[model samples]
Structure formats: C-alpha cells, structure tokens
Target: MLKNVLKSVGEYKKETILSPVTVALEVLLEVLIPYFMAVLIDKGINTGDMTEIIKYGMLLVVLAMAALAFGALSGHYAAVASAGFAKNLRKRMFYKVQDFSFLNIDHFSTSSLVTRMTTDITNVQNAYQMIIRVAVRAPIMLIMAFFMAFKVNSELATIYLWVIPILGIALAFIMTHVHPIFVRVFKTYDKLNNVVQENVHGIRVVKSFVREDFEEQKFKKISSSIYKDFTKAEKMIAFNAPVMQICVYTCMILISWIGANLIVGGTMTAGELTSMFTYTMQILMSLMMLSMIFVMTIMSKASVERINEVLIEVPDIANPEKPVTEVANGSIDFDHVSFSYSQNPEKLCLKDIDLHIKSGETIGIIGGTGSAKSSLVQLIPRLYDITSGTLKVGGRDVRDYDLEVLRDAVSMVLQKNVLFSGTIKENLRWGNPNATEEELIHACQLAQADDFIQTFPDQYDTYIEQGGSNVSGGQKQRICIARALLKKPAILILDDSTSAVDTKTDAMIQKAFIDEIPDTTRLIIAQRISSVQNADRIVVMDNGRITDVGTHEELLASSKIYQEVYYSQVKGAADNE
Candidate 1:
C-alpha cells in the first residue's frame, strides 16, 4: 500500500525531500540554542564579564532567527508536496475508473468510489503533511536533547529512560484500540454519502410519495452511526495528552530536585543545572509531538487501504493482444453463450443463447421484465464479457477486437436515455465530434426530434439540464436516438428507448430507419407489438431463454406465448376505440 501511494508523488519528489531536510536543520539549530544559553550563564553572567555575555547573546539571536527561517521553508514545501500528491492521486483513481468494465463498477459501487476519492483522499493528504515535517522533527529533537542532557550529567539523564518506556506502552495501547473503530467509521461514511446521493437523484419520487420525514430519519440513522463511532475513538485518543503530561511533569520534578542538590554539593554549577531544566522540556515536548503523529497515522491507515484498492484494481475487460482493429459488418453471432453477472453458472442471467444475425437485417426483441432482452444485445459491444462460450461481432470473437474499435462500430441508446449538461449540440457531438450542422439536423430528423427542437428559441443550440431534466420523457428519448444516429455505426441497438413516444411518432422513427439507413443492422427492443410487427424477424424471450423466433405472422400463428400477447394488446386497442 505504501509503495503504490508513493508513486503518485511523481513530480513532487524534490519538495518531499526538501521538507524533511529543512525540518532537520530547524531542529538542529533549536537544540544548539539551549547549550549556548548555558555558556552565557556560567562563563559570562557568573564570571561578571561583559564581553562574554554580549558575544554569547548575539550568537543565540542568530541561531534563533535561522531556525525560524528553516521552519517556515519546511512548512511551505510540505504544503505544496502534499497538495500536489493529492491531485495526482485523484487523477489516477479517476482514470482507472474510466477503464473499469460494468462488472468492475458493480463490485465497488458508485457511492463507495465517490467516498474513496473525496473524504479518504483528504485524510491521506493531511497525514502526508504531518509525516514529512512534525514526524521528522520529533525523533531528531528527542535524541539530540537527550544526548546533550547526558553530556551535562550522566546520572540525571537516566531519569528519561524510565519515563520513555512507560509513555511508549501507553501510546501503543491507545493506537491499537482506536484503529479498528476508525476503520468502521469510514465504512459508515460510505453509507452516509450513498444515502445523500440517492435522495437528491430521486427527489421527485420522494416528494410525490410525501416521504420527507422518512428520508430525514434514514439520513439521521447513518449520521448517528458515524458520530458514535468517532466519539468512541476520540475518547480513547484523549488518554494520550494526560498520559504525556504525567510523564513530562514527573521528569521535570526529578531533574529540578536532583540538580539543585548537586549544585548545593558543588558537583554541578548553576549554569549546568539551568540548562538541564531546558533539555527536560525539549525531550518531553518531542515525545508529545510523536504521540500526535501516532494518532494521525492510526486515523489515516484505513483511508490508505481504501485508496490503494482503487489504484491497484485491474479492469476486468481489456483489449486483447494483437486485437482485430476493424469490424467487417454488423453481423452478430451468439454461439452457445452463457452469462452471469456474478460469474457463477448457477445464477446465470442468460443461458445458451444461440442466434445468428446478418448484416443489414432488422430484428425486434420482446420479453417480460426479467427475460434478459437487454443482456443479449449488451454482449455485442463487450460491455460485460460472456461467462462461457463464443460471442462474435462481425464474424470474430468480441474479445478479439480492440475495445474502442468494437464499441465505436456498435451504437447503443440504452433504456435510461441519458443527456449531459450542455448545449444540445455539445451533447449530440458525443456521437460524432466533427458532425456538421447539416448532419446534426439530418440525424434529428430521422429520430423525429428535429420538429420539437426547432420550436425552442435556440433550436440545436439550446442548453440541456443535466440528465435532460428540462425536457419531457419522449423528448429525451428522441434526442438520445438522434445522438446515436450521428455515430453512423454498423449496428444500432435500441433497448426500449422509444417507450415514451406515441405510436405515430414511434412508427415514423422506424420508417426513417427502413428508408434512410437500411444497410445498418437495427435491433429494436420494445414492449409494444406494433413497434416490431413489421420487422424481418421478431424474437420472443422468456426466463433468460429464447422461446420463439420467427417473422411476425409466423409467431402469431404458431407460438402460444406470442399469440396471447398479441390478442391481449389488440383487444385493449379495440376497447379504447
């Protein structure tokens, strides 16, 4: 985990190195000041020599200013290095998510990924800054102060050794108890963020159902969990300060008592005893800083593990070696394919799907909600790899093609009908970045979207809210269809994309496909039989299996399931009339 995280410090290596170097210089100068004060006391003040006092005073002033300068430089370098490191880490995680296949995303979930990038990264960034500056300064100061005290009087210095072991054991116990609680708290944070995201995205449904109080309670529950866990962890860490204070004061009392006795016996001078008191404070203060570093490290350890999970995750789908670059045509062949979202054969969502589609053919797929109509078409673009068996696009295994080339050749307008926040022109250009105005209008016309777009003041240039929130359901579907049309792909899959449009408009869009792009293989998935009645062939799916395949008339005559669906729909229409 440490190795992976440090790789993000690519360009900031110089600043990372300089921060600790400057901190060491600051500590060194600070340690020397107390020793020089001892010289000014014994050689100058006690000896009543004005020259010695003034010379040592000036030297001490220079050391103090130099220490301040180095301390400020270290702070600046540590800040820059930590912030830049965070930027690089976020960039790497985002780019890695882009490469993740649908299966990969399902494993981590959207809310968890968002939490890892945001709150978790902030924790790691703060920890990095402390590690470079305070962490470096603490140990160096402790050792130097203790060494100087030993040089002054070896017997008195041994007091710190007894206190050191006791303080170390206390801090170790606090860190061990707090770390697991912190880990659990961050996981609760993921749930809290997930709740907020779901509430905002579905605010319309929530309001329509008048569930405001319910949402508030749900949010409070998760928030309360975090608060409780954090409180417990903090209560444990609170022991650190009092424990350090006990050790600090005990060492001071011991040093003062012993040094004064030694001074009275003339074994130690007044100057040496005064310096012993300063070294006692310095050594104990360094230990206090070290305890704070331990606390920060315990909190950030969980965050580091979460971030490393994203950084090292291998995308489940990738372009194979020596991949086929170009798709020959829109032909798709499913040869005994079986798929399970969980990759377990016992829980297969699609099973043994043997079907053949030629280039330029128009196919319609109809099925009940759980029948896997969308699953069959999704394999063409390799959005999710098949669990078993061969699935081919343009006469080659989908795994054999480069991911980008294969997906570009196949255009899919999914059931969700998403449109980003941008001008309509900008959103449509996702299909073809270089599409001309004429090409844009032509595709919209084919999808039966051009008429409504022209009614808006800006027409194609009109701004669309995120997810096309300002538009009606039918309008969003039509705009999405037009965008897919701009791709001009060999194969176009509409996964129940036109469900919101009226029958007349739906028929017109199908007619446009038949007239303008007859050579493009079109697979239309719909609930209405009227939408697919004129297809070259229609497929009926049930319970993850294809139960019937024929032209519309043949299925109506022979397939019992198809006949039942057709008669029910026809009776409903007649009743309406």
Candidate 2:
C-alpha cells in the first residue's frame, strides 16, 4: 500500500525532500538555544561579567532567527508537496475510471467512487503533511532535549525514563481503540454521500411523490450515525491530553523539589537546575506533539487503505498488444457467443448466440425485459467481452481491433438517452468534433429534430441544462438520435432510443434511415411492432436465446410470440379509441 501511494508523488520529489531537511535544521537550533542560556546564567551572571552575558545573549538571538527561518521554509514546502501529490492522485484515479470496463464499473457504486476521490484523498493529503513535518521534528526534538537535560544533571533526567513509558502506554491504548471507530465512520460517510446524490438526481420524482419529509428523515438518520461514531472516537482520543498533562506536571514538581535540596547541599548548581527545568518543558512538549501525530495517523490509516484500493486496481479491459487498426466493413458475425457479467459460467446472461449479419442490413430485435436484447448489441462494440466464442465486427474479431477504432466504426444510442450540458451544436459535435453547421442541421433533419430545434429562440445555439433536463422527453430522444447520426458510423444500434417519440415521428426517423445512409447496417431494438414492421428481418429473443427469426409478415404467420405481442398492442389501441 505504501509503495502504490508513493508512486503518485511524481514531480514533487524535491519539495517532499526539502520539507524534512528544513525541519531537521529548525530542531537543531531550537535544542541548542537552551544550552547557551545555561552558559550565560552560570559563567556570565554568576561572576557579574557584562561582556560574557552580551556574547552568549547575542549568539542566542542569531540562533533563534535561523530556527524561525527554517521553520517557515518547512511549512511552505510541506504545503506544496502534499497539495501537488493529492492533485496527481486524483488525476490518476479519474483516468483509471475512464479505462474501466462495464464489468469493472459494476463492482463499485457511484457514491463510493465520489467519496474516495474527494473526502478520502483530502484526509490523506493532510496526514501526509503532518507526517513529514511534525512526525520528523517530535522525536528528534525529544532526543536532543533529553540529552541536554542529562548533560546538565543526570539525576533529574532519570525522572523522564519512567514518565515516557507511562505516556506511551496511554497513547497506544487510545489509538488502538479509536482506530476501529474511525474506520467505521468513513464507511458511514459513503452512505451519507449516497443519500445526497440519489436525492439530488431524483428530486423531481421525490417532490412529485410529496416525499421531502421522508428524504429529510433518511438524511438525518445517516448524519446522526456519523455524529455518534465521531463523538465516540473523539472521547477516546481526549484521554491523551490529560495523560500527557499528568506526566508533565509530575516530572516538573519532582525536579523542582529534588533540585532545590541538592543546591542547598552544595551538590547541584542553581544554573544547572534552571537549565534542567527548561529541558523538561521541551521534552514534555515534544511528547505532546508526538501524541497528536499518532492520533492523525490512526484516523488516516483507513483512508489510506481505501485510496490505495483504487490506485492499485488493474483495469479489466485494455487494447491488444498488436491491434488491428482498420474495420473491414459494417458486417458483424456472432459465432457461438456467450456472456456473463460474473466470471462463473453458471451465471451466463446470454447463451449460445449465433447470428450472421451482412453489411447494410437493417435488423430489428424484440424481447421482454431481461431478454438480453441490449446485451447482444453491446458485445459488437466490445463494451463487455463475450465469455466464450468469437464475436466479430467489420469482419474482424473485436478484441483484435484497437478499441477506439472499433467503437468509432459502430455508433450505439443506448436505451437511456443522455445529453451533456452544452449548446445543441456542441452536443452534436460529440459524434463528430469537426462537423460543420450544415452537417449538424442535416443530421437533426434526418432524425426529425430540426423543426422543434428551430422553434426555440436561439435554435441550435440554445444551452442545454445538465442531463438535458430542460427539454421534454421526446425532444431529448430526438436530439440524441441526431447526435448519433452525426457519427455516420458503418453500423448504428438504437436500443429503444425512439420510445419517447410519437409513432409518426418514429416512422419518419425510420424512413429517413432507409432513404439516407443506405449502406449503414442498422440494429433497432423496440417494444412497438410498428417500429420494426418494415425491417428486412426481425429477431425474437427469450431467456437469453433466440426464439424465432423471420421478416414481419412471415413472423406474424409462423411465430407465436410475435403474433401475441402484435395483436395485444393493436387491441389496446382499439380499446382506447
């Protein structure tokens, strides 16, 4: 885990190295300052020599300034290193997500990914800065102060030997108990994020159902759970300060009482006792800082594990070593193909799909929900690889071709139509970035979207809200179809994309498909019989297998499934009238 996380500290190695170097320099000067103070007190003040006092005091002032300079430099470099490391870490995670296959993405929830990128990374960043600066300085400062204390008078320094062990046991107990609570708290954070994202995305449905009160109650429960967990963790960590205070005060009182008696006995000098008091404060203060560092490290350990999971995960999909660069033609052949989202063959979602489609053929697929109609088309683009058998697109195995080359040749308009927030022209250009204004209007015209688009004040230049929320369902579908048309792909698959449009508009879009782009192989999946009535051939799917295949009239006479669906829809329309 440590090795994986440190890989993202690229380009910031100098800053990371400089932070600790400066911190060590600052600690050196700070530890020496008290020693010089003892010298000025003993040799200069005791003898009533003004010259000796001036010399040592001037040296102390110069050392103090150097320490301040080093401390400031350490702070600046620590900030730069940690912030830059976080930026690089986020960038790597985001780009890794982009490369994940559909199977890879299915394993993680959207809320979990968002929380990891934002909150988890932030925690790691803060912990890293503290580790480099405070963690480095505390132990060094403690050792230096303890050594100087022993040099002044070894007897008083022995007081720390017992106190240090007592503080260590207390801190270790708190960290062990608090760490499990912190781990649970971060998992609760995932649930909190999930609630917020779901509520915001489905706000219209929530308000329409009059469930605002219910949502608020749900949010409060998760929020309260997080609060309870944090409070418990904090209560445990709060034990550290009191334990440190007890040790600090006990050592201070013992040293004062014991040293005064030694001074009166003419064994210990007053100047050495004073310096021992200063070193005692420095040693105890260093312990306090170390305790804080341990607390932060415990809290961030869970975050580190979560972040490292993403950084180390290998993508399930990648391009072939020697990829085929070109697609031969629109022709696709699925020979003994089978698929399952899981690795176990017993859980196959599609079974034994064997079909051969010629270039420029228009095919329609119809099935009940979960029949894997969409799954069949998805394989052609290598969105999810077939578990067994050969799936070919453009007469070459999809896995053999470069991923970008194959996907570019096959344009798929998914069941759930999506449009990003942009102008109509800008969204259309996703299919073809260099598409001219003329080409944009032409694609929309073929999809029968140009008329509705021109009705708006800004026409093609109008801004679309996120997820195309400002547009009606039918308008969104037509716009998406227009976007797909701009690709001019060799093969186009529409997975119930026209369901929102009226039958007349659906017919017009189909007619335009036949009139223009005659050589493009088209696969249309729909629930309505009329949508596929004019296709060259229709495929009926059931339980992950093909039940029947024939043209419209032949299917009406021969296939039981097709006959039932066609008549049911016709009867429903007649009853409405």
Which candidate tops TM-score?
1
Q: Model 1 over residues 1-577: C-alpha lDDT tens digits?
A: 8899989999999999999999999999998998999999999999999999999999999999999999999999999999999999999999999999999998888999999999999999999999999999999999999999999899899999998888889898988899999999989988998999999989999999999999999999999999999999999899988988998899889988998899999999888888888999999999999999999999999999999999899998998989999999999899999999988999999999999999999999988899999988888899999999999889999999999999999999987879999999999999999999999999999999999999999999999998898999999999999999999999999999999999999999999999999999999999999999999999999999999999999999998888888999999999999
Worst 10 residues of 1 by lDDT: 269-278
Q: Please list the C-alpha lDDT of all candidates, in the order they appear.
A: 0.94, 0.91
Question: Candidate 2 clashing pairs?
Answer: none
Prediction 1 TM-score vs. true: 0.97
Clashing pairs in model 1? none
* Model 2 per-residue lDDT tens digits across residues 1-577: 9788878899999999999999999999998998888899888999889999999989999999999999999999999999999999999889988988887777767788898899989988999999889888999999999999888888889999998889889888988899999889988999999999999989999999999999999999999999999999999899898999999899999999999999999988777888888888889999999999999999889888988887777777779999999888899899999999885689998999999899999999999999999989989988898999999888788999999999999999875788999999999999999999999999999999999999999999999999999999889888888889898899999999999999999999999999999999999999999999999999999989998898999999999999999999999999999
- The number of the candidate with the highest lDDT is 1
TM-score of each: 0.97, 0.96
